[model samples]
Target chain A: MSARRGAGVALFVIPALLGACSEEERAAAAPAAPAAVASASGTLDLELRDSLEIGLELLEDGSLRARVRAPRGFAVAADGAELSGVGRLVELRESEGTLYTARFSGAPVGGGPCGAEPVSLALSLHRRGDNAFVAGSLTPYCGADRWHGRPARTPLRLTGELPALAAPR
Target chain B: MSPPHRAPLGLAGAALVASALASSPAAAQEKFALAVFHFNAQYVAGGTLGFTLLPDPELDLDDPTTEDRIVTESLDPVLELYERHPSWGVDIEMQAYLLDVLGERHPAVLDRLRRMAKSGQLDVVSFHYSDQLFIAYPEEDWLRSQALAAETFARWDVPLGRSVFCQEGQAGRGLAARMVTAGYRTLMWPKNLLSYQRSEFDTDPFPLYRLGDAWMVPGGRSMDVTAGSTNISVRWTFMDDGELLATNDMNPYFPELFRHDPASVAAYEAEVAALEADGYVVSTVDDYVTHLETRITPREAPPLLDGTWQPGSTRAVAKWLGGKGLWPEERDAHVRSLDAAARRELVAAETAATAAGLDARERLDSAWRLLFLAEVSDASGINPFRGEMEYGLAHATEALRIASDTLAEAREALGLAGLAVDPESDAVTLATGADPLRGAAVAEAPLAIEVHAGDRATDTSWELVATGHHRVAIRFGAGDERQLWVGFPGDAAAPLVTTLALADSTPVSFDRAGFDFEEFWMALPVGLLSVGTDRFVIKDQATAHLAARIERGSGDVVFEDQTAPIGETATWVFHVFEGSAVDAVALAGRVNSHRRIER
Candidate 1:
């Protein structure tokens, strides 16, 4: 019975893989297709709905490092640009071709509109070919009551792929 | 031999009865012993969540894989003991998290556990979903932990007994009411060394005690109290969880320690055989309770003291609070900040979800689960690793984010989006008309607040932030090194000062003309302070990690912010109302600006 179940699973998976391969082939044949970016050696930009962009770097060990540009009024809202932190890759799922979904939990870092209360960033992105679509939000902490006027999560979204830069050494 | 006649008798009478029973052969045969085995596998290598079977060479026994292996291996000896002595009943008190691991790694072990419980050989007990420090977090977190434990138990089809055990025996004065509210009938607290030393009741007889009312009825019987009422009582049974046995060169109570040691196991088996040979009925707490007679202690029995197993004193909880470098002041501040954030977000999210009639139950449950996991006591107590604290902070942050997002969605659904309250302007209404403390003779004065550190006293100026109706909000700057206190003018006579206990919210009062200042100070673990005559309720801002106490010298209630960072300002709301202290607490929760999300 176990062997029969294995065969049944194989029967279901083969066609799915072939269909995915066909989709990849058709995408490659398309005139306007952008080259697939290597999972290694490049940075991914996650832009939220509010146009707050977070830069993500996938490391050699499958962990992630993230950075966000500080907004005005933040203590570290420096002219120097970004605050960075190492994070753990919470989840990663791949579905044939270049399609994948990734979620990472970043360490709390100071900056943003939340001031000294370190804000943790959780980035979720769906990758298709060169661009990975991003949807992100920020929750203010220092004190819960301090964020009354602020939306529970300041929303962010990433629309299209940006040029990939060399990964941080 | 038939059981001896049981009656409720005073301490003297009970001592006399005990003496008489010691000489009686029939009573000698009625000796009962209960053995409880606690199993926990929350300690993971690198403080990561989840279970694994691959052992880390560095962590050795402390590794999650090894911990699970040890627990699984320890079950064999327990099962053998049950098989060797079928008539004997024992308890396997486990954390719900351990049960989850068992289901995942060793399903057969769970099957065996279920069989033993079903066959009446074992009673399955739990100490919340995870081993959370009940006194450190909010009451809502406690309730959610128990609810999650129940869900885990149901999923495994395990029969959870009526009794609950406190992890590390870290119980408090307020726990009894909370446990009663949570639908538990019996509590098996193995470490009552402090209670035993202070109380008149002798431990030799091991009489069953009741909480909410200070009385011990000599009986092997249990009584059911009205469920959900804070005043309800529960049976308290004390057990010797191997600490006593280890002193006598017997096997230790923790299974992982003794399971692999043949000599220790033999010694434990011999000890059990000796008890049996001595005519003692060794069984589970549930079974042991059925065989005892009732001997009531005095009506003026001492209240149940709060502490943990270690140190065996009322001040044991302070070990977790600070000192010994176990939990530093800085970590305490961070964890407390996260705790306040998670709590307020959860409350607001739930309230908004209800108002908007949103069916986001799954999201809310997830948020609560993360918060409860974050509040596990292991993160701060004992020899806590830095990784554990980080794990807690991460989970807490995620939980806060989920709850905050849920609140936003609920508000949007209710057509209340973009509605906001300026904390600076929206002051709560203060009560007027007459002084509620008129009969108590406590005179209201201006904000005469002082910051005290050692011998130095600094009179801090306050800013009246807002005033409305019966509420007045005052803000003052406090240094990390000093103690912040708010004073009221009163005579030398001490008025009744009452406040809800830290975690459980049971009404705790302090009112002795010259009570020991240290004792009075230790009692008020939470921030809210209410004076006599139902007059004034002084509450600090929800985020502050302040310990409030009635100053012995001046009769003033002081809120000490020991964990406040440098340059931090504390805001306190003074509420005047005519109601009980419990009502004042409820009103404080309702009227606090932090609790409101204006539309």
Candidate 2:
């Protein structure tokens, strides 16, 4: 029933953003021209602060909506963010060559170096040619603590090439 | 390992293996008959349009491209397949309009179909021409639409199936009641070919189980050659295999399998055989129902439920608009527009036309037929394939147009000009017999009349003014419109009425189009009969203003003025519109103790 769910896929939900803006405000916020992502298939895995790693698989279900997964523990990547657990990329659209906007959310288990903090990340990405970059404010508290109503976030940014990969299921 | 006197050890082991094989998950094969249910639906042009900006598909009967696909592609291939495999049956679902189109485009194919139908090699499935949801229609409207479909098939000498198939194979609450009343036995879910509801069809011990008074055949995985290469191969699961039916939309199937690949066909047959050998029996849905009827079960009946096409969420349809799909806000807006128009114009017009006597019956039916076709469930919204929804809106608008025209005709025939209730005068003016076309007929005779407005003003000696025979103007002060009554002098040879008391005061014809009037008197024996416009309003003056349909049984006709009170003389009252044959006869019959209009 929530806009965050669809056909067994854990849809991308920017809870804070969704709750903060009305439909009109969101429409107004949409960029007049979003950049385009290449027709080729690819993946973007970025290692962030405290060994945190995020992986995005460009999935094809007729059109390009990505399959996303996140790091385990609270702070950093443990065994590298595996492209497991399918999550939908929301607002995955391209406009005005080389400008695209999309949002992703994921919370996978097991982060060794980050000390199993059970982190959950929500990121908004912009793609320019082969290069796709995302910058988001991450909550320092683990997903477990957040579940108990603790809110903590630190600014984070990452840029990386989207290497070609087999399309994720 | 075993006693010599007993079965040999090897033989015993072999017997155990065979037994296990028979009951294993692989042994879980059920009998399934492959029945390709074909559907070729088109949007009714000029019906209600959807809220989408998609280009609407035009309904061009002369254009072979549209209906041709239904035949050359869909039906032709199936017939060819049937010719090769006589036992493989295909069911074609169609409504009257589609059949008519088929008749025009592919008569030979249709004739072949008739032969196949006769030989039990093909089946014809009947559905509302509009393919509308039963829930959307009123009781009479629903029944009439169903009957019309049945009649269309009967007239064509084709036998229709008792089982109903709707989009998504979903039925709403009270579906059972409607189905039973219409003499239907089952509602088949076509979507079962693609989606499965484990709790409903798979998990339940019996998939073909009864739901309250009606029988439901739920979800099953359906795949066809046209389903893309990914779905071409058949996958059988032991749990949901009960009563599995395979369908092939031949014309639309992948080109590789269009002619029935020998290897693929052999493989399909092998699969069916494998299932049957394991313990399954193959039969069509009808035969399966018959089989179920012969079996006795103790499971409780499932209650009827309502929602969208699917059981749980309606998002499946909305899902189609996802990704690059912008929500069809325009589709919703168009739907609202259609609804508002129908409520304000169509419904009232239909009711009025129905009560306007035999002449207006055909017009009313035409309007209803168009309206029904425009409201198809999928074409209205569930389907976003093209501009299908837009066509529905167009059809609805056209239906409203027809209804408006019919209402005008009825009103003109009834000789209704307008009624103005001046709440300050305590008296009401009932305008009638205005001929805007030919000018108001000048009256050469005098007539007595009784006028009453809410018991405050009652005049038994009101006379028709000869000079302005077409005009009748009276203002009422603080009088309710419903309480106003006018009694015409029945004894006069004929009282000529020609105009209304409007500012223009033009003589309005009784049967011409475009004459405007608020409402008019009904069952009043005004001795004159006027034929001016092809349309007019028909109002029944009694305890309250009644819609045309409602006044069918309520209007009272009396032979003499004041001979009996309106309520007391209800029996002689036949509420015929002014231009109706009965209107003239009934008025003449009761006037001057003679001269009754012949039936």
Candidate 3:
């Protein structure tokens, strides 16, 4: 093989620190957009076709945070063996009555020159009533960065409903 | 004894044959087994800072704060794992320097290691003290470094196993010959670097081959579990990539996170089950060697190669260093300086001690140990982290000085005269005496010397000849006040030369369009340089440009450095036979040399 000099070929095998550094943790913890509501209760389960389960929770402010749980045989896509961990943060604003637009900004996981770049996902949902809702699939958008040594292009689809929020006291 | 010669086959053919043999159905019934070996050498060549971004360090050897974590987190688990799994044997090759660190700070770990060795669970193989590249230094220096490594292992009461486990799986010229001399029975290098394609490993009939006196197992297609891969069913070997097992708690492979899939463990178990069912013998590298030794009679010894063993045609150091902006000259020069100093020191210490009737083994041994500690391989120095490069260089410099000082002390104790040759500064330091040395073999004759105009000995090459009495044959050149034999021959009782100075000769200068010299002996359209009884540096007169050597009879050989002429006057250096009939004009015409020097 010809020499690949300074071609951004990171010679580091430091895979553990990927997606889990102090700076990245702080960034992932911070919400991307300001919230409109005061608080929220209950979780929204975006059940997908594959035994992959994504639990989204509405915060006190109007923002959504996700926790991913992989099936018994499978693992989280990019983070190898990380079955449960914080996934993504998206802004939730009501577009019309019973309709909501979820806006998500990319968040970097690993911290370093050669760390894996962030991949973002967005979703749109329509509420039938207070107890049930229909949601569209979240499209994974990873700009020219690699995850798990492969291009992060694997598509994600949501097949389940968002659970009812606890009624405000 | 010479190694057996295997008919060299084209690489393409070798790869195809290997690939075909890998899938052969007959292998299922045959004794197809694997030896799984795990090695952990947590070292950064220069340091974390030198290779990586500053302050953002993955591993910093200079920092004591990190050592505790490395020991408790990275090393402790592996030790514990070995103790827990007695049936799963392992061979660990630790950097001798790191072993010392462990001995000092973590004595408990040493006790554990001793226990493991006692239980026949772990065997410590011979390795470079600093994890240095064997090819980087001269053969003599390399052997000394290896010897010192054994001494370091003794410090921890660790026994030297028969095999030599080196990084990158590449052996330089004649390494096997030296290894045999050093008492190694088997040598193993990684398999990937040996061939351009991974499939090439299939062609070999067996895992081990005889190279000269030592048995060598060039990297896989061996039915071994050392290759780390999920597709062991398809891949010939089971080699681990060395990164799967985490060195610290943060590694995802940590014991807590190990159960997440546990693919490697499952793979190992499955392989053992399958191979055992087929009546194959599963064993470690050492055990495998022992097994082969016991089964194979004298007539059935492994096929030997004609010369020293070479794992691969390409050197990882050459490739890596080329990419890092440091070429062979930079590395070679530094290595040459270290080697010369060491050679003089060892010879001086031994000779002086003998003259003074004092034991010098302890002092020489100390110097040897220091030299070994400073011998960093190609895998080192490329660490982009902070402090690694500086750390290595600092220690190497200190060690060289200690060796030099010890030699000086030996000379002083014996009241023996000495000459010190400083290759870097091109100066000689002399200690005068009543009698000057005679009949010493400084270099082989007929001698050849090439000294450039500058004080730097980077361009100097010489073969010494002992002229009767106190005089030694030396070539005089353009360099002014260039000292010769500042350091006398290593012989302690031999007479030392007081001083030998060579005057700068009138140099043949070049002034014209830019010009360049080629390899030691190869010709360009303009001219050629050849090596015979003497070295020659033939240049164009337009303006002496950068000079280089080229061999005769080969036009396709690769030239090391290629630079365009800067249109400046430059002088090239060369040395020819003392009484050759070929004059400057005749020599110039032969090689198209517009400017020539045979002196």
**TM-score of the second chain, cand. 3:** 0.56
How far out, in Å, is residue B115 in model 3? 3.2
Please identify which of the two predictions, 1 or 3, would achieve the higher DockQ against the true structure: 1
- Write candidate 3's Cα lDDT for B404-481 as tens digits: 344445555655555342222322345432122113443443433333323323322232222211222222222232
Using Cα atoms with residue i matched to residue i, what is each candidate's TM-score against the true structure?
Answer: 0.60, 0.42, 0.47
Name model 2 segments beyond 4 Å from true. A1-169, B1-30, B34-38, B43-64, B137-141, B189-202, B219-282, B298-300, B308-313, B316-330, B336-340, B343-346, B383-386, B418-599
- Over the stretch B201-310, how does candidate 2's per-residue lDDT look in tens digits? 33323444464466655434432221111112122222121111122323321222223234534455566556445543333444444434433242343322222244
Highest-scoring model, TM-score: 1
Give the per-residue lDDT digits (tens) of candidate 1, residues B78-160.
65666577666677776787787788778877788887777667778885887666555555666778888988989998877
Q: Deviation in angstroms for B557 in model 2?
A: 50
What i-RMS does each candidate reach, in Å? 17.4, 31.4, 32.7
Please state the error at residue B112 of candidate 1 in Å. 2.4
Residue A122 of model 2, lDDT score: 30
Pick by lDDT: which candidate is best? 1
lDDT of 2 at B486: 42
Q: lDDT per prediction?
A: 0.45, 0.35, 0.36
Report residue B590 deviation for candidate 1 (angstroms): 3.2
